[model samples]
Target: MRIVACLNGDRRPGAHPALPVSADQLAADARAVVAAGATWLHVHPRDSRGGQALEPQVVTPLLAKLRAAVPGVPISVTTGLSAEPDPWRRYDLVQRWGALPDAATVDLAEPGAVEVARLLADRQVALEARLGTVQAARILTASGLADAFAYVLIGPAEPTVAQALETVTAVEAVLDRAGVALPRLLHGREQTAWPLLDTAIAADRDIRIGLEDTLLAPDGQEAEDNAGLVSQALARIAAHA
Candidate 1:
């Protein structure tokens, strides 16, 4: 199972004081996480005010810096609608990006997911479909683009561990039934983060950790940084093996 370290998401400034915001900060964190044993990296490139921004001006430099810091590591960026509500604008930004991610996530729950997936494929960027529910899985299956993706990111935003696991199972069943045999990257947010990480470890699924998922570590202490969270996760994975 490939362990991915999500350095940052659409987190606002001050959400976590140690959260990486600038290109330099993100690149440093990327290097730290990889050294801590993460083989994959997911990040939401940010703007001057630290909010998620999909514009090439914001994304290119951040991606360039990350590639420089972590050569050969697969990097992914979010194409989440929250960053750009207008589908045309989002598509345009991605098309114009000077530097591209090795892989990019297209949230199936979002509008224009199919178009985004096609654009990524055309650009030779591997696509990871972000399925948050059975409905999203069905949408991907219906689009007949299952083979266009490299992995299915089962990201359940459910607040409780039970709810999150249940959702992941349901989405998995849907994909299975549709013969979408892509490897899955399972993760959860906020309170469900560590519990789902434990689940992923037991299941040997592609998993992720960092300030993007939670500010607290598995023991419920404030995580020192992305590297610290990743180190703890790698230790748990090693013990499981």
Candidate 2:
């Protein structure tokens, strides 16, 4: 029942109505989503100019405020390529984090993913392995670093639902063959979000949903906010559970 509420992704504030950008805004939404039954939070801290960042200056204050806003729930941030593309710079940024999120995603699709992941492991920050493609999963398998992560998240990059599901199954099967038994967290982006969520539900795996996954509800209507999406996900989890 790990309902992760992703407040905002790499997208700017203008991408969605009231998308949380500032520290204050993200803190407010964190409290709101927790109240709405979200057990975990996945956040994107923004810089002064409103772009996602992993710089110590940008991430420190945000983590401080979030810890105050929602005291107990686990908070995670992205180490995805979108935040900072340069692998070495990304490594430097994460290495110097003034305050660290409880956990952080290390997407294997990006360059130097293994190196970055090893750094986070050395720092004792809990890891979430983001496998958005078959190649990423293979990389994880080849690296033999499955035990370092909190879980492996399958977020398919395929455009169609069938293709996405197929890739998810393939990735899982590959990991299974590699003796990687970490719990799986399944999600999809935009058009594939709801269907993949259902797939995760029926399979009884951990599921993530929020603006990062989609801007609309299951009925194809625009969602009010992260809380609304969490509420919807909770309802569906109940029904499927």
Per-candidate Cα RMSD to the true structure, in Å, reads 0.9, 0.9
Clash totals for all candidate models: 0, 0
Clashing pairs in 1: none
lDDT of 1 at 89: 92
Model 2: residues >4 Å from true position, as ranges? Answer: none
Worst 10 residues of 1 by lDDT: 8-17
Candidate 1 structure quality by residue, lDDT tens digits, 163-223: 9999999999998888888888889998998888889889878999989899998888899
**Model 2 clash tally, residue pairs:** 0
Looking at model 2, the pairs that clash are none
- Position 208, candidate 1: lDDT: 91
Question: Which portions of model 1 miss their true places by more than 4 Å?
Answer: none
CA shift of 132, model 2, Å: 0.9
